[model samples]
Target: MNTHRTAHRLVSRAATAAALATALGLGAVHTATASAPSAAPLSVRPAAPGPDGGWHQNGLHLTAAENKKVNGFVARARRAERAISPGVRAAARISHAELVGFDQRLKSPDSLKRKVATWMLESPGQTVDASLRKINDAVRFTLQWPAGTYSQGVRTAAGLLSAWGNDSTRWANTWNRPTGYKAINSAWRAPRSGQLFEVQFHTPESKAAQLETHKLYEEQRLPGTPPERVRELQEQQDAIFAAVPVPPGAERLTAPARRLPSPDPARRLPAPAPAPVG
Candidate 1:
């Protein structure tokens, strides 16, 4: 995910530059509504130097062990991406009104009763796929969200960063790393329209405390599991990705992704937007 954030930083800068250039009339006028440039295509670039003076050529300069960690992480994230994409698309189709209302709730930051909905819906295939990409950037790659969920997501994302940054080998250790979240569950309400919601934590202490009662989920929870289950749970774990169909571009992850077996769909995939009190 750091890769996504770092990469998106590049995209955002490009978008801003494009906008600024157009605004200054230094180039042909472009509409503000014009689409921002897509983030760089997924490629294995070299790692840059580490602050500690260790090797890091872009993302490729990691030590052999670190490289394995990274590769393992990317493969897992990719598989998760593929598995979850369809679920996001499916949920979107089945719960359009709920998502619309949920989207509206996002505008109100301090609603005591109306917490911002975690589940977002988008059309399947391209729209959903693109949105997933953005979420990966927003959640996994970027450090954009509040800390608990953010850090937990980031540690998991570190593996992906290793991958996109060209250090796919880091994954095994990355996959084996402890996930901080206690549980992932959903809730539904029809206050105005059908809406689904979820909450994730950022604090390591909280996640660790929460993890005690939910240890069964640990193995399949992050990059440690197989691709098939990743797809299956993608819908339940993250409704946004669950609703979309996995794109052809997603194949690299699904096919050669993690070597683990698929977790059971029933256990891995929860119902739409329910709360996880644990």
Candidate 2:
């Protein structure tokens, strides 16, 4: 569900140089905005990265303290990923049984690391602990339905969300993304571990459209891109999503309600069954 950070490091340096040039009155430059995660409720809204965010945006070259912070968060998140992975896979299997063509995947460790590093660079005000908690895609699943079954996909999503929440808590939901974005994204707090993970719903066509526009998103994140070009790219993305038909009642899906009485903090899932030897 992610990409472009490593690739953009050099571009960022060039932008820095351009900033220096502008200070000398050689030319003017436009600063870029914050971007979202891979396999996430990845948004392209403009945000000023907080000062003192402990990141030197020279492509995520963190100070020793900041590096330790990222490593600590990754270690904790990996354990959480292991704890919920079995249930997540089981849920995916049940989803396929309920309706065909749904695809599920977890974000790769490298991708997670990149997301964390870049997020810190974009938000210097938060400590790594707080930043990681806010990142919901460390473990994520994508459910892709065919074009005509958007409504059915949303229904399947409701069932999956209900089951997944038995041992997890729903902490975030964004069904009403701006018109330019075309997907449903949510996060849940895993029981006992208290780590957050992401869930996304997409139609086959919409998924393809997202992949098609990913590069544009990267370029739009560059500080040197003229403001007009940024606006143009957003319009292009909107047009692509506009062509995707919204199934009746798809927008009405709600974030699952918090569990009644809440899940016990000390509760733990039983050990997952061993995989069958093939």
Q: Can you tell me which runs of candidate 1 are displaced by over 4 Å?
A: 1-62, 97-278
lDDT (Cα, tens digit) per residue for candidate 2, span 99-182: 211122344433444566666667777566676666777666565555566555454444444433433345332334556767
In model 2, residue pairs whose N, Cα or C atoms come closer than 3 Å (at least 3 residues apart or on different chains), thus clashing, are: 1-38, 1-39, 32-223, 53-124
Span of 10 residues, lowest total lDDT, candidate 2: 28-37
Model 2 regions more than 4 Å off: 1-59, 97-124, 164-178, 261-278
Q: State the lDDT at 136 in candidate 2.
A: 72
Per residue, candidate 1 scores C-alpha lDDT tens digits across 1-278 of: 89657644442333333334333433211211221122122332324325653333212233344434434433444333322222222222221101111112111111110110111111223232232232221102101122323333333332222221112221111111133222222211122221222222112333333334343343344333577876555434343222223222212221112323224232222222211123
* Winner by lDDT: 2
Query: By TM-score, how accurate is candidate 2?
Result: 0.62
Assess the local accuracy of residue 8 in candidate 1 as a C-alpha lDDT between 0 and 100.
40
